[model samples]
Target chain A: MVNSFDVARLAGVSQSTVSRALRGDSKVSERTRTLVADAAKTLGYVPNLAGRALSSGRTNRIGLLVTDLSNEFYHRLIGPVVDRVDEHQHEVVLLADNQSTSDIPNRIISLGLDGVILATTTTDSVIPYKLREKNIPFVYFNRIAPAVPADAAVIDLTDGMQDLVNAIKRNGYKRVGAILGPKNATTGTLRANIFFELLAQNEIFVPFDYRVNGDFSIPAGLEGFQELMSREVPPDVIFCANDVVAMGAINAAHVYDIKVPEDVALVGFDDLPEAKWPIFSLSTVGFDLEKLAAVAVDLLFERIENPEADFKTVELPSYYVTRKSLP
Target chain B: MVNSFDVARLAGVSQSTVSRALRGDSKVSERTRTLVADAAKTLGYVPNLAGRALSSGRTNRIGLLVTDLSNEFYHRLIGPVVDRVDEHQHEVVLLADNQSTSDIPNRIISLGLDGVILATTTTDSVIPYKLREKNIPFVYFNRIAPAVPADAAVIDLTDGMQDLVNAIKRNGYKRVGAILGPKNATTGTLRANIFFELLAQNEIFVPFDYRVNGDFSIPAGLEGFQELMSREVPPDVIFCANDVVAMGAINAAHVYDIKVPEDVALVGFDDLPEAKWPIFSLSTVGFDLEKLAAVAVDLLFERIENPEADFKTVELPSYYVTRKSLP
Candidate 1:
């Protein structure tokens, strides 16, 4: 609870002098600045964020909004974003959305967030529209909302999917089973479409019974893999939406003593750090996710500082990471 | 920007009437409440947290201060703590002290945090001292500061360690090596001390060269295990501070083509959900981590509501989960 008054009292100066000294105002003498700082430190004084923010009308705090906080792929995105934001002396607040759709938009603004990076935007999401209508500066991470133009950092999956098709053709795999993410998600739908077209080009098509719908969760992957495994005829290879899902599916297959890339092959997306583990050498689509996250944070800052700036879309290219899980 | 005035205009009532109706005050007629609710929905009127907090002198927000958010263990802990906090309609602000400490008590208070849960408090943290001096309500989640007395939810590692030791002895493990966490951390120091005492009671003497220091990180575990393996005569069994660390060590071993259990048996602590994965089958300690996290959140809220309540230390018991890695 120590304040400027206490610092001033110890420094033999007025409270105004203490404030100026702390704020690095030119009016405060060099000798007085040292005296005030030492006193403040001794008294364990911390600057009140609200007081400073209210007076200056500036909160150097940005919110990083993500749907899933515990996901390994998502968690890896936080470090680079936070580090980059901190370099500019701004704070990053992690706002995990567990709210209903109706509550999200208002809640974001009600918190008086200076800006936000939408790390999990969907094509049909109203968040972009609401933020735009409210004139709130935001940038999308790993997702591009085509409907509402905004600065975005996205991963281009076309090249990787083409390579995956090539691999499937080389292996002579005709029956492929897939665990796709929610159909509503831009990523899931886009990947599925691209993958289908590539498969067509390779003269292969999976039956409707071979595909299972799920959200991006381990349990969903396990359930989806189980459904596919118990089919009239199991698939030659199983493709998962991401490495985490693939890990779960592989584990589930292990429960049945199914050898990876022998009994069945597996391919995933988002080459997470865990994918390289010795126990599970999962092949996946790769991109610089951390750098992509940093780009999103940078984009948000740019939009906040220069709202009139041209909206830019950064499409990071992805490639296949060949490993033991996929032939 | 639909304020009370707009709601009042739409409801055909005074601004005060609209406010009363919104709060469901009995002074307002039931007919007026319906009108006000309908107007609020139409105008998208959400209550201002600042105005409410100003009048009530409280903000329904708490801080969860963690040293490492990217760690899988803490990531898992977040889900349960957040679920509990969400049920109480409280917002969580993340505070991280990644490598060094900050003035936590003053910072939390300035941010208007009602309480805080510390997930990674070192033994001699200044945070506990400052919080005690400020009379701020706080709770420890799997961690406690020695200087401050407070409600804490922690795991008792005695049972699990004992079970693991019995398994090792029964299997004729003559020599043991341990990768302990930082010397300053209470959990690390406590586990190491208890483990050594039990080993000695079992008439097993651990060689000085078998011990390695770490910071509870994968890299630390990897390097520490390498350091141990470099010894002329390595131990027969290796015990890591936690599952993540054990995984790192196991991976390091895998790189050298060292077969686990046959080459060197491994054990771990805090058997994470992934330990039971067929790929890992990591023998380690087991406790209800979700329940432990929920208990910590509950303790924080209890401290906030009843500041004068008796300080209690709740220790959750752990047991051994025998898996392939240890056998």
Candidate 2:
């Protein structure tokens, strides 16, 4: 309940002096700063956060806009972002970007956010355009808008795809089917292209009907799995776009009374935490998303500090995790 | 980025008038209010959040301090809390309260949080003591301190447990082992007592060796399941401390190649979203956690508005959810 004014009054110092001392401004002598600090500490006096915020014109706060707050993937992403933001003495305000119809940029500006981190922007997203027009400093998270070039932290799925193909070929699997994400998604496009390209190099051809489409949801994966099962002859192995999709496929397999690795092999992308659970233990390719998030946070800070800095895209390497879900 | 000063300058009014007009505060003259508002909209001017925060001495922001940000249960609770907070033109600051042994309250104050919703407090938690001493407004979310008796939203599992007992009896599953959380926890003690009392009513008992204790985590559930399995004859059914613990038990069953319901029945508490997933359709106690969260958010605001308001406790009813996991 105690404010800086109370500390100033107790220390017999002016309010401005208290502010200067607290901020460690060079105008205030070291002795005065120490005295003010001691009194502040003794009284448990904290600066009026509201007043300090007004003076600096910065709340020392950043906006973290995520599309899906409930997604397991997003939850994993939040951990690293929080750590990185906290390290910079900045607090992140979560903005659940519900739909395209939401007035996100305006809300972010109204909140007086120092900067915005677009962790959930899509390729066709108008969020970046609006933010850029407003001159509101923003850094893209995992996904990116090619038309609006900004700093981003992305995974290059190239290496992982190569390994995925090599593994499949060595395991003597030819009939392969893929449960991919939405066609419009950059992650989907990149992942699928890279996967097929690597497969072509290994002389592994995928049938057109073997591909199933999903929207990166568990239900989507389940539907895709059913599509594969309904085939005249189900593929020997099924590759999912992401772990969420894979889990859904496995769940569908259970419902269909199909055994994993015995009847068919399952592989997933994004080695999420649940992938290693004793229940699933799914085999998949994974990168350190936590590190990627930290880098994204740091990138945003860097971009905010140096707006003219060249846009740099950091690509993290991925590796396959061997588990019971795959042979 | 334009502030009240810009709008006031354009509208030929004082900054105070601009603030009153923008906020729709009644003291401002209607003509002046309209002119100020028009200028604000035309110029796309947004109020300096810090300046408004300074004058009001309040930020419409509440903190939800929780442990384990990656948990699915938290995800389910967050949506309702966010909805209620947004209705008050307020935001919930997500704080990961993972450091269980740290000075929780001091850290909260340091963060300059307006108020906190304690979602993971134990009965003997020092956080309540510190907040009470500081006269900081906080409400218990899904957890309560009976000693302090502040505003709380707790789930009464009596009905759920009663139904569970009856179901167990009717199904002819007599031996019931428990995977309980920490002994000092309010939920731990409360649920344990209720379970024992309800079992006594049905004349079904659990021997001392049939119990396994740990934190409310998946590993704890696995360990408890293993411990129970080591007995001369494992219990026919296991009642977990919560949904997550139940999942751990289920995973353990899978690991040991035991079937659910047929070989052993597993029942969880707090029917999380994952509980309904086809992979793990865990039957557990169901309650309106979304509504519970909204109540907790509303309680914090109520306390903020009227600190002298009678400290109240809210208990919500829980019911049994029969699924494939249980007979």
Candidate 3:
């Protein structure tokens, strides 16, 4: 097995120059880098990864921090993120957020991750602060902490919300019901606020009794729909916080023998794959989910490579997809 | 920061002994191990993971290699496997098996995984041989490579098949249509064999045109059901390879305006979470999926610790669940 020393000798460069060239460091002139690369290929030189990592202090492993693995929404993001991370020649280590926020810094240290993607950061989570204090590179994925200024990729729900509200008013839906996500979550809170404000503009109000809060789960959607349906006269339409909740509501409707679009129109956010099934036909807020996931990976890698670069937020746009459930 | 040397000095042992004891090496006596553990705990010494990895050639990172990330069945296993791996003080690295078999050995070598779980190995996959050649620890998860013998955790479909066949016979179903898994996969071949054998015992035959092979996916189920439905005299019942396929068939039924259990009854294997939805009420073969995933992780770690141990296969039992879809 030929080593980088052999390649360096053949290329007429120092071993340190060989290392920098192989790492694609810009400090190494492009011409020298090409010569080193050619020599390495000719010699069949496979760089010792462990030796390189120890020398450079880089793990080449990224951590994806997630709170809920059972959520289809979160798991769906893993595929695209993994694909993107693979392109960067890095492996992904799934880090479950089951431990306390204070334990996160220690966990990251123990795992030896080069960087992390906070996929499920709550607004109040102290993890961002801890990570910043430790100087561990990280980027918020689909969620943001107002107090801890950091890189993020989020969904812009403006156009989607406008389309949804217009459709609801046109459908002659007066009374409304809602199954909102937990108030602590930025995603849930922002979506609920936008939904209610749009409804208010159209002179539609959902009473307190007709609104319920869930933890963005199927069971939550089912129970929330059941609780609202027990009213003297249930609201005509229910806007779910997400597609998972909307699916639950639809399942509940089946159990109650309530006809969708005839008895109650159901709408959801995050047009997940399940939402497009002919059996569901769930009208939903749609965006390029794969692209969002890919962009999050990209932003995290960008931050990792250029730590001094100013933090920025990348907001992906969303639109409404009309389906049988809404019509 | 307390290093291993501090713990070794306090425990009255060599630093090498301290490291081996912390790794739970059989060479270290139980008393010595306990002393080292206690000393390390008292000093609050978090072992330097990267340093240990380099010295011991053990990264404590397990790889889960999957072929398709879009499949819900594969994603669902991540939670339980992650939980089990956490108990063993190892982190999981998600590796996609999208590249050719020739590229797998290099991919594994580059990732620097301590061990791997082959979650989606096809019968023809050469991954097991490559892993063996590399001397990397691995265990088959819910799949088997007959060409390469190894440890595996699989579901026993016997009891479930008996119950399903009995139900079909009792319901007076003569004509049957089926969606079987891929011919190259052990899971698909085994399931199809058992199903057809039992049906033959009762003198019920599924004609070739009424039978189709799928990759155990929703789209496969939809297309298979559609092909059978176009028959001049369609089969009264359709059995899907798995719940995902069953869901697709159910969705296609909705699209074609065909009533489930009235126009046609549908049954599936692998009672996934979506099968229990009131809207689907899919009757499926049920088993302890979490336990199977947990056992796979256990087997992998067991092999890692005792590489010389004889390879064994663990089979979890399954039963048929009766739901509205079957009736």
Candidate 4:
């Protein structure tokens, strides 16, 4: 029940000054802000989110819209996004886009999220348009919708793919296979484009049978790898869409008793924590996923606070991590 | 601007009936509820959570208070918990217990959460007390606080540990090393008690130097295993506090070039999804974590709707999973 009045009384400041201080308005001096904050802490005063939202038009709650909650790849982003949101004095509302449930736009409005970070927007997704119609600010993380442009943080896989192709060439693996992600997704298409272009430039061609499409999942990798291996002339190497798929491929290799880097080499993108485990040591295209997630949060907050800010697309650097999987 | 009145007009029902139908009151007949829901959907009406909270005293948001956000072990639980919550027309607000930030109880109140599910309560944690003081309904998940009794969903590790120890005896392995979890944790203490008691019954004892305490983290497992291995006569087998720690021990074993099941067998608890990866196949105790998380949410909702109901403790079944690590 503690309110700004109690904090102001305890801090010996005017009620308006206490409100401004608590709201992080620059008009309030640091000394007064600290004084009010300390008093608020002592009084155990927590500004009601609903009241604050009504008064300041900000809920301090950001939604992270993920399409696939079961995917472990999304799991890695939650911690980093939450950490950065917490740094900005905000909390995360994990919004899973389940088709069976109510639409995401309704959930966002119902929950009163200040902004949203779309981590799994397909190129043709209508979510961005819905968000724009509602005047809800959103930042795309690792994916983009050209139809409805917004702030985005995406990976530049050009350099990493080149390094991986070079490594493949050096190892003299001619028959190559690939488990590509869905062509509808920007992340999947971009990586596939870079991967195939690099390999084609090196006179390496993956047969149609060897080129399988997955949903960037573990089962996709397992099934794709198994399908490739079942062929009369199996591929000597498999390039997966991402680490989760690559892990599946590795597991499949184990099931078939195929030695990594000996029977068939595997390379993955994203280089999730599991790829780095000593047992796997999966060589993968690497980027700071934590940093990418954090930046997406930062961009979303910036857009929320400054709606007039120019739309930005931050392309982070990537490199190939040479590990036992390839060597 | 579309409100219950608009839905009521479209559905040819009274405004209060629309409200009751939207709030899922059983008093509203199924056909009327269906008509109201369809009308609301057609109008794209999102009931304002703040207004609804003041009127109905329900926020439809649940806080999942976790101590460690960076751990992958917690990541597996989030998806299932969110799915279950969404099934009941609720959303999850991920709340991390960071001391540098505002206290959890204050955050809970500020966020206007209907209930909370405490997933990481150490035995000495003050969170339970704070929640009780505020009369906030909560359910303990896989952990408990003796000072404050509440509804809980936890695994019964007694039978599983017995099976594990019996397998250990049958294998004729001795000079066992253990990485026990923090003694202050209910989960850690309970598991350790079962482990040691079973070993004692089998006339096997772990030397003081062989038994180490960890905080149930990856680094803790790595350090504990390394410490045990550094002894002049290292134990033939190592039991970790949990799956995360067990993975650490397995990684440490790989680092020392010790062949699993040949040089030192490894055992873990929890049997996380990663433990079943073909690359790992980690021997561990198994329980239905998804069910456990879902039941915690269920218990919290039960307490929220029927606060006078006697608190119930749901003990889930557990068993031992023997995989390549033990073989």
Candidate 5:
């Protein structure tokens, strides 16, 4: 419990001088800085972040707001983001939007974060507007809210979808079923629109009853697949919103004793690590997930450092990764 | 960015009065508190946590120190911990020990956290000693460092191990290969000792060459399985350290075209959500993960509130879950 005052007493300097010296403020002389540092290290005095933040208006803490921590996708995303943030000497404060409370913006504000990386914002979320009103710097990750302009790192699924459509056409799949994510999410809506448009252009039409939208969850995929299969005529090919959903669909297929690719082709987006597992071997739209995380952290830091800078959106390209799931 | 001064000016009170009223100090008049609250709401002022922390040495922040963020085990653990911490009106600060800097203890101290929950401490780690020297309160989650005694929530593998050993005896498996976790971790060492002791009691002896120790990871499992299978006489059954490693072994078996439970039986610990997946259907030891998280968080909060209380360790019991992985 050694405090700055203790270090100051041991170093024979004023408490303010000790603070400045320990902070490496150039105002303090080199000799004073060394003396203070030695004294602090001897006493094992760890400077409190709150006091430092009060003096410098920076907490060196960034908020990573994710919606679902249980999702496998976030499992990979959180690690890279934490590593990158650590490189900048900032800690990550995990914030989950799982609670039904609408005071998430206020919670973020109360934490006194330097900035936030919004990994779970929906297209219609009011959090962005509230944050804008409070002048809190934030950057969108994977999803964006049009109500407020901000920096974002998102994926362009056009090329990948095109390649997937080509595969569908070549495979001569007559009926196609889709299990999309929630409509409120930009990732879901945009991916669905692009997929449907591409499929139409390729003369592969999905009937209205063949499409289902749910949250990006395994249960949703499982139920969606069951519902689609019970239809009068099931689609030979099923497109899942993401790898998690695809895995769920595969699990459902296993329960029903349906063989993958041989009986029904399954394709997914976001080729997460599990997609490549020998058992899953899921065909998915792939992108550099680590790169996406790095870009998002970069954008958030940029927004924090240059608050008045022009809002920029960095869209990373995606590609199709063919595996055993697709015929 | 409305400061306390703005609220004080609008409320016709001193800045200190405004602060006291907002913090619900008993000395402040109810009428004055209402006036300050109204003014604060009107100005949209969010109290700076730094200022609050400086005044009342509590950050209301709890740190959850984890070794591997990419591990699916943590993915499930983090959500429940976050949820439990949130119920106490506190935020969770995620601290990963992935860096080789050896300054993790210092980093925790610098964050000014009220307490920490250690989820990944090796038995020989110096972190517990450092935290104890600093008088920082922490509770062990899943793993513990025996050097410094503290509150902990651990698992007891006796019942589960006994059941599993009974299953092994019933199946009449003569040769056994094992993929254990790191020798440095208490979990790995404890589980291995218990399993081996139980097997010895039942007159089942594993040859020295059939055991491979590794970190609790998929890659480790895969590599360990490969190494074991290459032996002149490969064992018929493989015991994985945990579910994640079990998955890697399963993947390796699939790649080598080895039929699980037919060519080789696999048994894993920590029956993770993926264990019951139709693709995996792994037989493993099961515990209430959510309850463990809650107990850890509760122990942390208890220690934070009463630092002088005698350290208590709550050991949750585990059970064996049967599936296709084990014959």
Candidate 6:
């Protein structure tokens, strides 16, 4: 039951000084901070974050809002985001936007998070607007709500898609099929649009029946691939929205006894770690995952520090990685 | 700017009643709760958890302490844990026990978490002791610190190990090798001990040089497999610490142009989702992951509600899953 008062008495400092030292206030000298830390440790005086948060209106906790926790794509981002947030002496709480949960914005507000990194915002998501209304700072991680002007770290799929399309043309892929991600997600919509535009420009048009739109998930890819393959004349090549989806497509190929590349070439975006596995050897668009995560966290911290600061969108470049999946 | 008072006024209730209704206190009438909720929604009043936490001595925030967020094994557990915690109307904050940062216990206290699900406790870890001293409620998720008696949801490896060893013996494997997990970790040490004992009972002994102890990670599996393979006499069958490590071993096999089961049979514990991938078809020890996560959360909540309750250890059963990895 030792309190800050006990630590202050032991450290021969005032209660306010003890608080300042423990909070790592720059005004407190390093020597004083060390002394206060030692005294606090000796007394087992854990600082009351609730009381401090009440006073300073800062919780030092950020909410990482993700749509699907089961997806491997978000799994890759969590570690990097947590590490970067830790550098700022902040904690990351997972805020799942479960489709069944309708009160996420209220929950986020109730938690009193210092900021949030929105990794699952769809193009028309209402969460961003709700956050803005409440003055809760948030940065879009991989997707953005176009209606809301906010800081975001996104991938530039233009060059990567162009390169992939060119490669497909060079390989003489007669019929192209695609397993697209959710149309509502900018990550899915933007990538699909740019890819189709590039393909059309390259004189290789994908038929309407050749494309399937689903969420960025393995099941989506598996079902989409199955649907496309059921066609009387299936496409010679299938472009998956992301690596997770490509893995699903690969799984579907296994289920259907179809050999990849020889039967139907497959390409995926976001060169996830599994894409490099010898079994997959998947051709994908690669980007610096760590940088993307760092950027998202940095943008969130910036928004937290300066709510009035003009929002900015930073786009990281992506490059195509040719692997055994491509013919 | 909207607060509880405004909602209370609008809902025709006292401020305390509004608070009780919003908090879902059982004493509050159902009609009053609905009225308060509607009023709060109309006014856009989000309850301040910090203020409520200070008065109630509860934050409704639980910490999920994990060692490695990058590993896929933990990935499978995260979603289930989050969902189960959500059912209790509690939020899950991820607390990474980074090796370099030694003030984790203090961080946990500072966060004022209601309870913690320790998913990464080593046998000799000081975290459990610190948590115990502070009277912080915690439940061991998968690993336990034997020194500290607390509620734990762990896997019983006896049946699985016995079955796996019987299979190995039936296959007529003369040589056996293992990539063991860290000796300090109960998950590693316990699994290794049980496997070895069962192997010895079946009259199969693993040579000293045939074992390499490392963390339960892919790199550990990969390096261990490589090291064992480089030996003049490699074991015909290699057992990995866990599925992630087994994947690393598989990767190494590919790197060395060694066909699995043909060149060297392999086995792994923890039948992760990726184990079912056609590329892996990893033979592993399987358990009810969702049940384990739910049980861990339930134990922590029980400890939180009744701190004086007798500590209980719930051991879930594990079973062997045979796949293409085994000869």
RMSD to truth, every model: 4.7, 3.6, 3.0, 2.0, 3.8, 2.6
- DockQ, candidate 6, comes to 0.60
DockQ of prediction 1: 0.38
Tell me the TM-score of model 1. Answer: 0.84
Q: Sorted by lDDT, highest first, which candidate order results?
A: 6, 5, 4, 3, 2, 1
Q: Candidate 2 on A127-226: residue-level lDDT in tens?
A: 7888888777788776778899888888878777777787788789989999998877777767888888889888888899999888777898889999
- Cα displacement (angstroms), candidate 3, residue B276, comes to 1.1
Where is model 6 chain B poorest over a 10-residue stretch in terms of lDDT?
Answer: B94-103
Q: Candidate 1: misplaced stretches above 4 Å?
A: A1-45, A56-60, A88-93, A98-102, A121-124, A162-176, A204-207, A229-234, A308-310, B4-43, B53-59, B99-112, B133-136, B170-172, B225-234, B306-310
> Model 5, B145-232: lDDT tens per residue?
7778999999988899999999999999988889998888898888888998999998888888999988888899899999999999
Q: What DockQ does predicted model 4 obtain?
A: 0.60
Which candidate tops TM-score?
4
Identify the runs in model 2 with alpha carbons over 4 angstroms from their true place: A1-40, A99-102, B1-43, B99-103
Residues A1-327, candidate 1, lDDT per residue (tens digit)? 577788889999998788768756677889989998899889978666555555555555687887776666666676667667765545666666654422677776665667889887356778889889878889988877888899998888888888888888888888999999888888787888888888977778878899998877777778988999999899989989888889889888878888888988999988887888866788888888777877788888788878999999888899988888886
Recovered native contacts, candidate 2: 0.51
Interface RMSD values, listed in order for every candidate: 3.3, 2.9, 3.1, 2.0, 1.8, 2.0
What Cα-based lDDT does every candidate model obtain? 0.79, 0.80, 0.86, 0.86, 0.88, 0.88
Model 4 chain B TM at: 0.97
Tens-place lDDT per residue, model 3, B74-173, is: 7788888888888787889888777332255667865678899998747888788988977888999887887778899998889999999998998888
The local lDDT score (0 to 100) that residue B251 gets in candidate 6 is 85
| Pairs clashing within candidate 3 | none
Estimate candidate 5's alpha-carbon lDDT, on a 0 to 1 scale. 0.88
On residues A55-124, what C-alpha lDDT tens digit does candidate 5 reach at each position?
Answer: 8888888999988878777777888898888877788888877765426888898888899999993676
